[model samples]
Target: MKPSFLASLLLAAVLGAGGSILLTHASPAQAQTSTASTDTVTIFVDATFGFRKKHMATQLTKTHAEYAARGYRYVDMAPYNENGDLVGFFVTYSKQ
Candidate 1:
């Protein structure tokens, strides 16, 4: 192999490894702050195949109440599908 080619490959490998190490050593607090900056409250809910609309409504209400009790302002509700027969929901909130 040519000397210049081998040097370039070694430099690239070193840079990639350094970048990965930096990311891995990042502080958890920094990560949390970054995530919090994107949104205030994050709720994750999952229900089984037989979960009814009413059940979801009730669960959402309760989740809202809990957030309210914690002095969080309600933002939005996002729903998603989990697996094949489970439904997932997210209730966003922000500190008041």
Candidate 2:
């Protein structure tokens, strides 16, 4: 418990805490931006289970039409299979 060693430990602790605070918080001017993070989102549609309810074709067409009206593009789709039959859908859509 030397006095010099205690002072050094106190200094290190203060510096470490200050550094942590500076790194964790962003200043006000640096926080805002006019740009968006991205223009697309991936949606997983439970088309398989819903297929029995609305009967796939009718449901899909109506949903797609709604998205198109909103200026979204249906980029890609993946069908989930269960017992060798397609049951669910994963769709990627994008808009500016």
Candidate 3:
């Protein structure tokens, strides 16, 4: 094999490994938090009705405020489903 080709392959391999490591370490805690959020959303959806995206957004905002007042960090609010009469919502938060 040509030297330049070998160097390029080596660089690619190193970059790939570095990227994998960075991605792995960067979000382990976030991933756990995301799992927790999914659980929370499932619970919230199960306990509520008429959860449209717009309504969920407002509700999540209020929930975040309430949680924040109690010392929590809000990560995000995502709409899972939006079919007519069957809506789903997910709220994500991180501990402060």
Best model per lDDT: 1
Q: How does candidate 1 score on lDDT?
A: 0.62
Better of 1 and 3 by lDDT: 1
The Cα local distance difference test for each model comes to 0.62, 0.60, 0.51
Task: Between candidates 2 and 3, name the one with more favorable TM-score.
Answer: 2
Candidate 1's residue-wise lDDT over 1-96, tens digit each? 999999999999999989855543343111112254554756565443244545766766877888789887887766755345435566677777
Q: Which candidate is the best by TM-score?
A: 1
Error of 1 at 14 (Å): 37
Candidate 2's C-alpha runs over 4 A off are: 1-38, 50-54
The list of candidate 3 runs beyond 4 A from truth reads: 1-54, 82-86
How much is the lDDT of residue 68 in candidate 1?
88
Worst 10 residues of 1 by lDDT: 25-34
Clash totals for all candidate models? 0, 1, 0
In candidate 3, residue 51 scores what lDDT?
Answer: 24
TM-score of each: 0.50, 0.49, 0.39
